[model samples]
Target: MNWLRRMMYGRYGSDQLNVAMLVLSIALLLVSRLLRIRIFYWLSFILLVLCYLRMFSRNITRRHEENQKFLRYWFPMRERWYRMTDNLRDCRTHRHFKCRNCGQKLRVPRGRGKVSITCPRCGNQFLGKT
Candidate 1:
């Protein structure tokens, strides 16, 4: 499939790290079969999914040339960074904290606060001491 190679080879740009990561993941998957490590195999499969997710996720989203250098130069690896933009946006909106017992995400007010919080999910009681 020359079209497939041409399509993959020249879009935005290319990445050695992603290619290396993909290759490493495939190798790990193969090795896990020999080593009988189920976790390694599952993790290798997950990494492969992440590699593909990194590759084609941009087709569904918008891209900017100025703000994202990699998105301009090599778009395939931009998904993780693109996903982080939501977290960065949330970080701009309010304060984020973790629960002590269950590590739940708690978003409090953006400013200094003397507030008591109970995590609804974990029922952990803690003060918002930020």
Candidate 2:
């Protein structure tokens, strides 16, 4: 453990981008094995190598910048994914609707029959069946 710490003392270490790359590499490897695709196997190997290179890099600033750029793209997509999953999980108890006037997403309780929805953003009233 002491030797490992010494080895990584000046390294950039792991960041979100590296972790994501590692996960994607593993997923690609699994897909390659399942589909018997040689290209995916190679791609996964390349990604794995890149992940390790980034982890052991000595340029901390560059690694930080790369992680920031990755986050800028990853956060919004991640939020959308979480929102979709949450909506799926809540499908039994809630209904989701978009306001036609302002396109704001509104959540309404399920089995409410016909209800009037007021958009809080623009105060747009719309009727929908829940």
Candidate 3:
């Protein structure tokens, strides 16, 4: 592992953007293969190249800036994905509701009857059964 560490010593190395690009590339490759689409193949190749280029880049500052920019958009989507998974996992144990005023997400325990939900964001009050 000494050689690998030395090789990456001055490189930007891996980041979330790199991993996301790799996954995107694989997804594109699968779709391209299944659909026999030439455009997706090219897009996947481009993504792979970009991923490698970012990995091997010596400009750490630029890479960090790029990663921060990527995260600005990635984080919200990631949070939503996490929330969806959590909701699915707790489907039997908890109930999720959206605030009618601010659209904020609220969670209450399952099987609670006629619970009054107060929206923390907009201070809206509503009654619902959990």
lDDT of each: 0.70, 0.96, 0.95
Point out the higher-scoring one by TM-score: 1 or 2.
2
State model 2's lDDT: 0.96
Q: Could you tell me which residue pairs clash in candidate 1?
A: none
lDDT of 3 at 67: 95
Candidate 1: Cα lDDT at 50: 65
Alpha-carbon error at 1 in model 3, in Å?
Answer: 3.0
Q: Sorted by lDDT, highest first, which candidate order results?
A: 2, 3, 1
Candidate 3 or 2, higher TM-score: 2
Misplaced by over 4 Å in model 1 are 1-76
Candidate 2, residue 14: lDDT: 95
Candidate 1 backbone overlaps, count: 0
For each candidate, how many residue pairs have backbone atoms clashing (under 3 Å)? 0, 0, 0
Which model scores highest in lDDT?
2
Candidates in order: C-alpha RMSD to true structure = 13.7, 4.3, 5.7
Give one digit per residue, the lDDT tens place, for model 3 in 40-90.
999999999999999999999999999999999999999999999986889
* Shift in Å, residue 117, candidate 2: 11
Off by over 4 Å in 2: 95-130
Q: How do the residues 24-96 of candidate 1 rate in per-residue lDDT, one tens digit apiece?
A: 8989888899998899898888878766665654542322232255435556556677878988987876887
